[model samples]
Target: MNLRRILAGGTATIFATTALVACSSSDSEDGEGPIRIGTTDASKSAWTVFEEQAEARDIDLEVVNFGDYSTPNQALSQDELDVNLFQHLKFLAEYNVGSDDDLTPVGASEIVPLALFWKDKDSLDGIEGESIALPNDPSNQGRAINVLVQAGLITLKTPGLITPTPADIDEEASKVSIIPVDAAQTTVAYGEGTPAIINNSFLDRAGIDPNTAVFEDDPESEEAEPYINVFVTKAEDAEDPRVAELVELWHSEEVQNAVATDSAGTSVPVERNAAELQEILDRLEEAERNA
Candidate 1:
């Protein structure tokens, strides 16, 4: 609001304010300049297609790659990036809460489902007494548990929760020994012929064929809503015309084809409005506040 100081000044004060406002505006509007998008190597192939598709439409959308998961949100919040296509709702909520920033989603992007990889067993039924490795991160660990619970391999004492640890397992009713491993270690563990849970992003690095997944979760479910990847901008840009345009481009047939074909069906595109994403963020923020 205080873009300029007007001490009962003339029209010159008004011009300064106008310039500041324009400077702060998102690059997404009118395709005037390149809109930088932050993402990781996991979605590198799909984003390449998105970038190409965006350029042909007269929009200069650029994808900026980062090696670590923690860098993109920081870059976006600092205005070093225009928007980000890297994080899901729960992770974003956690980042927003932890950083005390107001970053919000402008559009829902995709839901990369978690898969269970088995070495010796063909199905969950034959995996009795096997020590199955799971991602140790909070959000992923919970999702890994849910996949096993749904597959009847394991049961949680607290069912339907977003994050359940190894302690939450109900030993009496479970069929497999669920073990926690470093999220990056899941692929290595699974590659050793040990049954394990692997996230879609890490499948390529782990050298695992996604087609060999014994079980996968329904990413469209209400429980999976928090896991949906999104195009996030600052809260102020939520309703920007350019943000809407970029989102529309993503959901268009051209980009959708790129997302599907380039990602090899790993990133499932899900179109959701800002309201739906905000609702989930609000709930998470409230939970954080209470905690």
Candidate 2:
């Protein structure tokens, strides 16, 4: 992770102009293949911006959309994709630790909030002793706890830790009991009348409106760095010139604007250099191992 903001004035306009020119004038450059990118529907529009921007650099950026979260990284690990742009640093670090993969981030993307969703209930005030459903995975469980603490439904004896467990819950002060289930199960888990903390990635499948979220994290805060999504590639390609250009274009006004509008203003764009990001990843991975 050696990311830096590609700060050049009028870069977005240049990218747009170059992309339009290349797309209309050329098919493929000598010794260059399409730069395949894998991501979810949430960021598809944002990638479209990157794809177009890549054209200006004579790189044919192809987007491979995945319906399930599990397959994108698997494909990337197997060389099925040149890069992937969906997972946050925590999820990616957890995946790398578990799979022994060396996939790494090259650019900071967006930070989507972990929201509390409930059907037939307007707010947390109406709920009580509810058997709340949340992610069972170590990385996200702690995030859910932080959201609960913010909502005043529970308290952590030691607050602000990136990874917290139910054992960390102050039960006597907790307004609701937690039912930890698999990450995908959280969507259906909410249907059973128990409010659940849902990751933004699964909101479409869960059919919940993000704006209606009863609680959310502060996307601009330092606490949100661990959750920022990123443009990632295998460790070996981290500094490939083409990858560098793609990452630079990602921070361009066009792509950043797409991220804001396409996510319906839910995901917040944040910038972090590689060294700073790696520091966060190291801490998260250590916590995952201990958990």
Candidate 3:
């Protein structure tokens, strides 16, 4: 059972011309073909375990790896892939509303804490009035802003806005100013001696230690619901039992252990049924529409 992997780049332009493939279905009663799933974490050992487990159940699985956050959804939306497991509720909401699509989440994975990496500073102390770089993407940018708020470095005008922008920052009340850069550039900013709020995905590539973060949001907190990574598929396929089985398999001790090891134990496993996950996505979509 060979697991095929497709490596994409950070830019969407590289994926723009990808030829559309036949849409996949979770209901494979005839044992048609492999159920192809897209993800950014294909290199992780957890996926190898997942594939092995799926093969044991006579489930043909193919894992297509993506580099950028944009293409998986695009491929999924275009019916080129069956399902993708790379984003959280907030990111999915943003993509759905912005693209006018209804790609749905079928299972909850885990939430990896976003952290503020300061190569120089030991803590948030004495960082007042300094510039901190963060991901500019809508979903992460808002979360990044909240991390600062949680760190007592900044205050938002709307108090508890989960997806606030830089304009929403109460400049006079905040201790530090935010520099919104491309998501990948956060490390570049940090490398240049500026403090950066980076996503866990970029940590390994940048050789930044996840434990070195001066501050990080609590993954177990209720406020972290929007950040829970999910297995997403087309809305029509949300009720597929095969997909649900695959989701459950992800929580198996073997796969879960591999996931924890891959993320350096920073990834907190979460268990929310499809309905609960959908409710969170709905609320986030509503907020995104309003915003």
Candidate 4:
């Protein structure tokens, strides 16, 4: 993917500071120390396979798990983690814009469809005037709204916005109202008989089969570009060969099998190069700034 030139000729400025820490894996000899990676899904079996694959290549890896979405980038920026692989470009754009950071994606990962689950309802029909549950976070909330729009349940005041929020909904024209809840609690709301937009991470933990979703957004659609997951590191470390190697390892057959299993066959693996990912991130960051 030529991750060595992630931001080469890109719009974002790269700082000239030295390494964040003296013992950073970037500075260490090959396999000298563990490359610390922050993720929200360390317990997923895919990560175990990823770790074993890294070991096979003499790349020591330490998987640091985070409980929430807010901390991984902070940990990476603070030099506590070498990289993070949890969020999509949209979420990362929001974080980068909000925090004024330039962490860059080194490779593209899979995109899992954000799906609607209902405990009682079998389809989108008969849900008029119903309260739908969605993740309260801006990124997921916006995507959830789009999912409803695609399902013919809602309409937006302004069509085609990348990160539309609940406020952007044309409530007068929409058939259903939204109830924003924590991402982890969407399953709870679903169990309570509310049709919820559940992210893949929370689906498996709650014992929900992703394939059983009543409705789901198409992962390969143009609107899904912002939702493509990625492996991100500080912009300064973008060119590290080891980082590229780690990204390549993630696509290995064994690791991808685990990923498919972990995501219950919902994950659509993507293969965008570093420059392509950076271009997407740049566009998202610009939209975030204007929004």
Best candidate according to lDDT: 3
Best by TM-score, which number? 3
Q: How close is candidate 2 to the true structure, as a TM-score?
A: 0.73
lDDT of 1 by residue, 1-291 (tens): 011111111234344334323444454444465676667643445565666666677765555555567767876776656777778888888888899999998898778788899875566676888899999888889889888887788888977766667888998889888879989998888878889999876887766778788888888776688888888988866676666787888787777877776556776888888888889778867755664
Instruction: Please provide, for model 4 over 174-274, each residue's C-alpha lDDT reduced to its tens digit, 9 standing for 90 to 100.
Output: 99999999999899999888899998878878888787889999887767889999999999888877788888999999999999998789998989998
Model 1: lDDT equals 0.74
Off by over 4 Å in 1: 1-32, 288-291
Clashes of 1: 0
Q: What TM-score, over all chains together, does every model reach?
A: 0.82, 0.73, 0.85, 0.81
Candidate 4: stretches off by over 4 Å = 1-26, 29-34
**For candidate 2, lDDT tens digit of each residue in 48-103?**
66666666666656666555666678766756567778788889888988998878
lDDT, model 1, position 158: 77
Per-residue lDDT for 279 in model 1?
92
Alpha carbon lDDT of each predicted model: 0.74, 0.73, 0.84, 0.81
- At residue 233, what lDDT does model 3 achieve? 88
